[model samples]
Target: MTAAEGHGAMTAAVGSGATTVVEGRIAGTASSARVTVRGGRIHRIERLTGDAAAVIVPGLVDAQINGYEGHDVNDEHVDGGTIRRMAAALWARGVTTFLPTVITAEEERIVGSLRAVRDARALHPVLGHAVHGAHVEGPHLSAGDGARGAHDPARMRPADVAEFHRWRQAAGGIVRIVTVAPEVAGAVEYIRQVSLECLVALGHSSANAAEALAGADAGARLSTHLGNGVARTLPRHPNLVWEQLADPRLSAGFIADGHHLDAAAFGAMVRAKGVDRSLLVSDAVALASAGRPPGDYRTPVGGEVTLHEGRRLTLRGSELLAGAVKTLDECLSWAVAAAGIPLADAVRMASENPAALLGLTTRGRLQSGAAADLTVYDDEPSIGRTPANVTIVAGTCVHRGPSDAGLAELGEIPEELR
Candidate 1:
């Protein structure tokens, strides 16, 4: 069962014209307050007497996601059910908005996945609100080794505007972002045209500095998982990473799960791009979650993959990493713990930066005018204390802890999980 269904019924009735009050400490602070929600927007926030009850912040947004927990969006048989479950699972974490990424696949298969996401949104209110759109990540990428990453080399093809139109139509015009290889034939022209329809991003490229800049000039505005999609070795003077970092036009997405990028590199790159131009994306797959045993697993997209020690996932027999196995919530904690980034900056990368890049002004912020989408933790996230987090969407309480227990689990009594 999806987390929504597994949690029984929602605590707040939808469209009931009711006001909901949430008591919490503003996340990253020690102050306590009560937030009032009405008509799906935060009505007011007033200080409350007593210690801070919970840790609250704007709902997290993920730009690139493949799957999470046991639900695989790119599985061969993915459908509306898969999208629904994926949304439910992510909501159980702190992610309130995300782009369900459909990676390198055949034309028909890709269309099918897009249609499924579109249909799921139409059929379910919670799922629809949580999903922003589809992030089409491939079929137009570098075919060379190392750069290709987990995508099949044979499936990599030149960018084609016509194919993108077809995918967009299949997704009911909800295709928000598309990733392209800057060096591929017709890439510049393809980016110019497709970007008019949706945001075009650069990734999986075996291109030099000039071509990368050319792609940006062609209206490519984001770099997909900047550090991980290119060759491991590069010339010291000029490379795609340096060019993308130096250019201010492109906002970059990062898989900050500690496996796709090391702490030092992640810190340096974030510093270069600044928190406003940098976003944290899971780039996660089916096996993604907090903890899973080390073993061999089969997936339709990656074929044979292995979950190694320390939550690292890789191709069964290769040194190249496969995909991220952590959620945006976990990645936020990781950034603060390992990268030396401030907690507020890391949260902005996970929420505000991505929402602004996508033009979603109503989300990714905590204020009276913002939408009532929030994530609440029982306590601050640190090495010793991991507290339970609860998700609130449009004044509705969706997911609590594992057993889905009492309101006291929100930290008045004790810290549970964060």
Candidate 2:
């Protein structure tokens, strides 16, 4: 069989030299181009004259990930080793950078988990580069039943800036994003203060439209999985959903996985928020066991959960969603093919836009001088049994995939990477 048929052993050269070359059509444009990478950055890009079926796009940046491939971030005993493994699992699936999310756990667990993530980054350069920071998604959320979703309502509490400082101190300033409920006591002030150092977001709330806008005015610039985190039933008119979409100051993060939103609903939201203001987030939890059969399972994060026939995860006895199960790359494909989103826009939502939201100017982009984080789809991007091509994290060829089985076969990670 030829090299191309082998899924890129000879087709793509990773670590080829201080400088490497890749030629393809940039996503969202008709122009085919050649991009040169030197010393972990894009050195140059030039238009190429050829028939190139390959599509080169920015690397995917997932804003919220609780865990992946059975590594649970919120597990009671989570440590640096868990984070190290999760980063590698994400890399194989084409997620170059992700925010390891910690939800409404106890105060001790939250800080301990953040410290572990910081230690993981300190101990491994690859993980340090791959993990942007920790996203604290709870403890500041509403305690109300329906609005709290799968989170333990008993663990919910009013927003406290003192505890927030402890989180920053523990993570070595790695707490980059925080999600809160505007209606909660002290939340607006918390947003006002934390916004100076972090990306303040609003989520898991029972806030009315005016209250939601107040949070946005208080420097809450992003919405966490906007359409999904609120109460199951809300006033038909003037709800947080409509208010969030209409507000120009806030960028909305969306989960384009099939179970989250159908094509028409996703299309409407994208149009409402405008393609430029919308971003994609997986909101993934640790359930991606490659080839692990779908069935019932007990988990520490969301007790008594079931991984269903079609990759949707839910509480064992209820219709409520436990958490997302799809990877960011797969979410992008569904947005384009099933959700009626334009491929270019979907790519941006999955990559560039999310990076920009978090203030990472050089990440999730395709340009000269940007970090050489990239994904090359063999043809046009699509989801199948394989990743379909090569993925580079900081110019290091990390994934050349046929299946996720590569993780076990890659042998022991060198000490530095460990």
Candidate 3:
């Protein structure tokens, strides 16, 4: 029986307009809800009286997820099976839809990972796989060692539209987001080229205000991991981060995992960019499982990075910091309480904001005719603790709490199972 049915039906009648009533704490308000979902879209929302005073929020849309659940997308050995498995794992983590981010790797490896994601998407067109698109972090980026971060300096270079076109084809037309350094030669034109077809992001570069704005003018809509993938000691004024955050035309994405940026920095960026233009991405690596154990994490371009502590990891760049440990949910929490962002606004950053930034049509909002993606969480209004328990992708439960079992698995082909 479903969780609600398992508790025995205690019907609380509402307007006949209701189809499926979801009871939970609404935003930061007192626990209440009678959210109706029909035809895989939220039909209506109303306050309801119920005992399980939980909260219902929109499911998260992560534009960047390099790896999770013991599977790294950058790893050369990643296959269709691994991609499907990873997609399933993310769904359980409250991600309704996500871009399978393949970070800097050899050209061949990037091509392979893109193909794997494409195959997985094709195999499961429904939200089961939840592969809305693919995010290519890049080999075509800055050459400066510091700017390149964990990306192999050798692989990093100026933009080449021909190479990107080849990679896009190999991705089975599933490539939607591509990160490029506007400072690189030919990158401006290349941004226009790729942005014509996909969402281009400015990342791993040392572009100043003029160059960064040029990228935005060239149709670069998002900045990948805003504060994490750039030079360490940027000039105090008019750097890429400041420019991107200040430009109203451009949208910014954050790792939100406090490790990516301190509370102060994170709050400043949010202030500059505004919640409407800011998005939460879990630039999570392959070892994002519980128990912050140190492990070797392989990247698409670089060989591996050793997770050393909660915030530190050894990567290709001698002094570059690696990916973080926190989930997108945790990131949202920090943004809300610690960063002093409103709960509704923080939810937008984790959901609607990313969807708008990435140009996703029917996601991010819990409104009628939108994709039925939802994140159910336990909320402590007093302490402002909101932890996600279940993630529903396309109206089907993907991840559940320890209390929930027998939840449906996504992208699992019965024929392939023994």
Candidate 4:
């Protein structure tokens, strides 16, 4: 669907006058609840029966997404239309809100992409509501092998406040998260400065325990994809992995796509961070939803990449992963299956924790006065076994799966989903 069509569909759904009430067993609670939504905000939540078969949870929130459905977020050609398509695709996957993450690139490319996203938010209603903000992931990361991942080493550089100001201006101050290498020159001060405006996350680094702690002291509060962007092997003592895992002040984001981390490692990290401090991120790329066959394919960056079995993308002929390719729902399923986390806790990691991390109070909860963003599914914990039956954004049914006959009877598919 076109951008205008997507916006029009979302407007029609949310602008309707009637109230919407959904009944299901609420996540993180024992009883089933009747959630009342009116004028796009939750009007009331009344506990009724405790025997509902379906599960209801707050809509998933993805803090980091590079691209999806064959549209690259960092591509210079990216525009408002691309943003709309991405938003619609995410909505179908049960994401009510997300950040279009822009990774390390040249100054002009980064600024242009940021401006495009800002403009998309202003021009498209669905995208405007779904895109909470922009996530800037690099240009200030480590250049060493494994640490750099697929980011271009030639464009990598130390932190610069002036450059950051330009990016903020380009994005109209919508940048909510910035990831940096703690070991970069002037990075600690950069974190201190930017933390005043947005969250500062450490990633793509080879920092030791001391350096990581220094970054934390200077206001870095998060580790971006903790175990992935580091060397394959490290010294046994005082390494970046152990350091970040042990730091109480830093919450870590993990890509629970099953391939990014081993099951044992994923379980250990979750245990270390505990349920309250850990968050889930989908660092997915365009190829994630492109429907392309598994094999080698060239990309704008990362050169030639290979899509392996289970949709894992990696640098051609190399052991390094290009980026994640799973939706947050799939990641949640992996968390439940691989790490043995409770389904409720996995949902929280995909929703509440990231919302709290971003200071978004209204979007992540299913309480009175909060936005009516929610997902309905069957009792199965595996995401694929029980895909979102219905996804509501701001009290409007935007996506109704084949099994959601009730929702489909209410209305046709939104143009955004088409």
Candidate 5:
């Protein structure tokens, strides 16, 4: 097949220098363009043409994603096939890189998931190549039944550094973020130790302002799904959630699916934390891609993950989300249309801020010398109209929809995989 048939987009040497000039808007900016790839890296960007059919933005980076396309990373049987499918599904959603988040579960299950991720890397090197790393969301978190969400009560233990170390080793050093509750015993030290190698985030906690601040001081730099994974109600002032948001040193992620936070509270965060420090997480589940039917949805926890129905349906679950029903791109759309955030700012929340939290300099931006991880949206200055028309990773086109895949699924599998 021809290169155009394979990628839906044509790649030809442009200009006198054998350069590939991708002319399109950067984010929502109506007329800016980016030119990339020289010596196997992004060379430069310039505004060369009028607004193209799509806006070119960095491919999204979601720091917290539990599952996708019917695969839960925390499930008892998180096999390599599941991880591969999850990665493929995520890429189809315009995610060039993400942290395959594993939430609270049994120790053995956690190890199994980590090893599955490791084995996926071994079997499909493209997955590892796209994966920013793993985000181990907690068994060493809050013990409060309400606060810990769907975390298995039996496995809820004190912050165990050795266990985290073991998980890191088992995953072939893919642990990039660990979210814990500062209120847990020895949580501060665990945060300190883990932050030395990977990012530590505070979440699923009953901690007050002081405890939250202590975690921040101990090197906790992120708050996972800031308001979703906490108690039902918090103290009027200086609450842990409020404290984490008010602190300038900590960057917080939020589930912008509109179910996690109300319009007012979500807007308040945007105003309080500013776009630079506020990240957007899909917090989606395995059911996100194919979509879930009206029935009981099972979670790692005992009961099923349910969604209420009405003019609006709220996700019903303890702490872990109902299921992956939203993509990071969709979350960005909600942040813009629902919360009234700027299109560019919402894009940054979905990409740059999350990348910063993960300490991933290579995967977030469209700057010269960075990886050409880009997404082209079909619609315009309004984010709601922008659909992911094309996705490029490392200057290579991985997805092109009907214009490329022709109804069949497309994959980025490398020849030497496994």
Candidate 6:
């Protein structure tokens, strides 16, 4: 069935209502529960028959997303319509909230992208509701080789409060996150200033332990994709990785897709950061599941890249990774299977932890008074093995898998998704 048809079918099944009832085993709890949703908020949760096998968890919240389904957040030409399409696609994957991350680029492009996202949110309710805020990942990062990732070195610059003000203004004051290299000149002061308005993260850095601690003291609370953006080799001790992991003041985000970190490394990170302090970030790019044929393609910043195994995208002819291609749902699955983390903890890392990081109180929970954004899976161990059978955002059933035949009949695929 086409995506549009699927969406319509799901919508018809879950008509607009003052209240709705959903029955399933709640994540992080042992027994099944009947959750009542009213006015887009969870009104009540009551224990039900424990035999029900379906798993219900809060919808995933992604802290960092560059692009998806052919829409690049940093693209100068990106528009509101494109952002809306991306929102719909993300809904189908059980992501109810996310940040549209803009990486290092020219000043004009950054402002334009922020404005485009702001306009998209205003014009499309779906995009607006799903987009938590804007994440400025660069134009303030280390210029070293591996530390820079796919960002253009020519565009790299020191943190500037004036530029940040312009970006926040363009984004309609919804810019919630900024990533900077702590060792950069005036970075501590920058973090101190931005921390009042948004969360600050440290990334793409060659900072020493002292510098890392200093940034944390300055209100830089997160380590963006901690283990991924750094020199290939590091000093055995007193390295940036160890520094961030050892610091309890900083929570760390990781790209849990299999390619970003091996099983051993993933386990180690989860151990160091502990479940509560770790966050899962997609860090996906525009070509994610774009259905482009498996072959080499030149990206605007990542140089020549290859799409392999139908999922992995990498810089061509090198062991160096390019960017992530999986969604947060896929990453969650991998986290449970590969990292040996409990399913409940994995869900918290994806939802609750990030919500707390962003200071969003109404989201990332399935309790009373919380927003009724939930994902229902078919069975146990739903992490990597099961897809979301139903995804509801704010008490609205926005997506249902093809298995739900009771919904309206399928229709043609949406042009945007195609």
Question: Which sections of candidate 2 miss by over 4 Å?
Answer: 1-11, 381-385, 403-418
- lDDT of each residue in 1-418, candidate 3, tens digit only: 1122212222222212223345565565554655566656776665445544456778778888887777877776887777777777766566777888887766888899888887776665553337787898887777675677777777676788998889877776788899998988899999998888888999988788799999999989889888877877789887888888888888889877666788899989888888778888988777777676766656543456777666455674344666665667777877876778888888788888888766776788866677777766655342113335555566554555643322222322233310
Residue 18 C-alpha lDDT in model 3: 20
Best by lDDT: 4
Let me know the TM-score candidate 2 reaches against the reference structure: 0.92
TM-score against native, each model: 0.91, 0.92, 0.87, 0.92, 0.87, 0.91
Candidate 2 per-residue C-alpha lDDT over 132-189 given as tens digits, one digit per residue, 9 for 90 to 100: 8899998989877567867888888989999999998877899989999999999999
Error of 1 at 261 (Å): 1.1
Clashes of 6: 1
In candidate 6, what are the lDDT values of residues 122-195, reduced to their tens digit? 86454567787789898889888778877778999888998899888766898889999999888999999999
In model 6, which regions exceed 4 Å deviation? Answer: 1-16, 290-293, 300-303, 381-387, 406-418
Q: Which segments of candidate 5 are over 4 A away from where they belong?
A: 1-21, 38-40, 301-303, 310-324, 381-387, 403-418
User: Model 6, poorest ten-residue lDDT window?
Assistant: 1-10
Kindly report the root-mean-square deviation of model 1 from the true structure over all alpha carbons. 6.6
For candidate 5, lDDT tens digit of each residue in 288-390?
Answer: 6543565566665334666544112223543344434677888888888888988889888888778776767776787888877776655544343333556
Q: Which 10 consecutive residues of model 1 have the lowest summed lDDT?
A: 1-10
Q: Give the Å error, residue 185, model 4.
A: 1.6
Error of 5 at 388 (Å): 2.4
lDDT of each model, Cα atoms only? 0.80, 0.80, 0.71, 0.81, 0.72, 0.79
- Model 4 Cα lDDT, one tens digit per residue, 1-418: 0011111111111223458767767765565766778877888887653366666779899998898778777877988778777877777678888999888899999998888788778864656778888999999999889999989899998899889999988789989999999999999999999999899999999888898889999998999999988877788988988888888899999999988998889988999888889999989888877356899987754768999987889999998999877888888888888789888898889988898899978887888999888877765553534457778877777777666644533466556544
lDDT of 5 at 39: 49
Q: What is the C-alpha local distance difference test score of candidate 2?
A: 0.80
Sliding window of 10 residues with minimal summed lDDT for model 3: 1-10
Estimate the TM-score for candidate 6: 0.91
Cα lDDT over the full model 1: 0.80
